[model samples]
Target chain A: MPKAELLDPQGQAVQSAMGRLGFSGVVSVRQGKRFEIEVEGQITEERRIELEHLAETLLANPVIENHTLTIE
Target chain B: MPKAELLDPQGQAVQSAMGRLGFSGVVSVRQGKRFEIEVEGQITEERRIELEHLAETLLANPVIENHTLTIE
Candidate 1:
């Protein structure tokens, strides 16, 4: 089996924080969880990227969330 | 910093496991990592996706590796 890191959603995701209009405000801490995926094929480089795109666009919440794919 | 799962490299990552060549040979477990990012801008929807793409293409390894972007 190949390896993958699924970016699942977390509770109370902090999207942004207020700044003094001086700091420009930063996304202090965007948090998320991960899962495992068992797929088919050679796990080629191109397929990996394609899979990642699928994760971000479909598996994950595009509105306020995103996922990082990890292969081992 | 903005929450970002950096798909960093791990040692001896198991990409696939052999079955009787039967398990159809699956990608059993793809592993990856997460990190924090502090960027400039509103962290808008488009921006978030853009950031994720950057992570996948540049920050992450395209071959035998991919990263899932998570925004909290």
Candidate 2:
């Protein structure tokens, strides 16, 4: 399995919302998108790298967001 | 720090898109939202639970999505 998350650079809206809701302890919030993927076969090292590239090129917009990949 | 992810139960659109993109090895893709929160102080056990409830009630739609919390 490959999990990819595309994170926002700034998340002021959510942070302020939490503050208004009385959860003032929340200092910051960065919103993002997560994609859980199931692949057909064993995920080799090369395949993992390929998936990271795909996450950057297709699943996430590199200009406004950053992505991280985890294999499990 | 607290991280929450709201996950979609069904993920057909992304799966199909990956298939069309020549990534036939990808069997499934479930899209979701990820929130990274920075808190003002130490996250105690009670605070962690409170955050989980907040994630379920405010951050994610219980009818269509499920949420998971991670403390880091």
lDDT of 2 by residue, B1-72 (tens): 112243334466777766777777876678877887889889999889878878987888787677789999
lDDT of 1 at A52: 71
**For every candidate, C-alpha RMSD to the true structure in Å:** 11.7, 5.6
Misplaced by over 4 Å in model 1 are A1-31, B1-72
- DockQ, computed on Cα atoms, for candidate 2: 0.53
Candidate 1 chain A worst ten-residue window by lDDT: A11-20
- Point to the candidate with the largest DockQ: 2
User: Candidate 2, residue A20: CA error in Å?
Assistant: 1.8
Instruction: Give lDDT tens digits, candidate 2, residues A1-72.
Output: 112243334467777777777777877687777888889889999888878878888888787677889999
Interface RMSD of 2: 4.1
- Evaluate residue B15 in candidate 1 and report its C-alpha lDDT on the 0 to 100 scale: 29
Number of the top TM-score candidate: 2
